[model samples]
Target: MIGSVANMLAHVKNCSKARKVLIYIPYSKFKFNLLLAFERYGFVKRVSLLRYSTNRSEILIELAYNGYYNMIQDIVQVSKPGQRIYWKKKQLRVKHQIGTYFLSTSNGIKTNLDSTCVGGEVICNLV
Candidate 1:
């Protein structure tokens, strides 16, 4: 039942708030790409794929922090099943340079660092 991106984002946000060393999440390609984006921008320490319950797979994400502060100040789910948000290439705007967005682009999942410009659902914003 916990297969939605919103659920995953909420889990990550909660883990960040608790300052968990490691968090286990269900396998999802989009999730994997999203984690990679976070890692690319130094928001996360590590991401590993491991077998879970012998048959299924899971992702282990290592939260990043400096001193006593967590790297992520807040993470908000932008596109949901109930409501979807999309921005065209012309409308693309990055509110925060340090903030990163998980976008479901036509080509694939992309981060703000990439400048190709794609129009798709904005999954979540992480900072």
Candidate 2:
């Protein structure tokens, strides 16, 4: 399982098509580690970290793609927080059944997001 996960991470790091990445971490420590890693590798351009819930402890990361497609396949291995999210791509139709806010770029481009939750609406913007 570890090998397979590593292989997937490698693939993501090698992908040359992705332009943006969004990561959500629920813990401050883990979020800090991820931020350090990003800085160490210089993988993304702009990164936004948002605090979700206090009791639950969650974070949301928004990464802007500059021109580095070589870091897409890198897989982050960590246990999901009480409230966590993962978004992979930036081009797809998004639908939300519950009350949710949709965040997009000024030009309005569809962002790619791979989310795993018990129940919630998915939001994205490709710009």
Most lDDT-accurate candidate: 1
TM per candidate comes to 0.86, 0.33
Computed on alpha carbons, the lDDT of every model, listed in order, comes to 0.79, 0.36
For candidate 2, the 10 contiguous residues with the lowest summed lDDT are 118-127
* RMSD score of candidate 1 (Å): 2.5
Compose the digit string of candidate 1's lDDT tens values, residues 1-127.
Answer: 2136677788889989988989999887778888887888888899988886777999999999999999988998777776788877655664644567777887877765578856677777787
For candidate 2, what's the RMSD? 16.2
lDDT of 2 by residue, 1-127 (tens): 3234234334334442454365544445433443444444444444455555555554444443555444333344331324334333332224552222222223231222323222222221111
Worst 10 residues of 1 by lDDT: 90-99
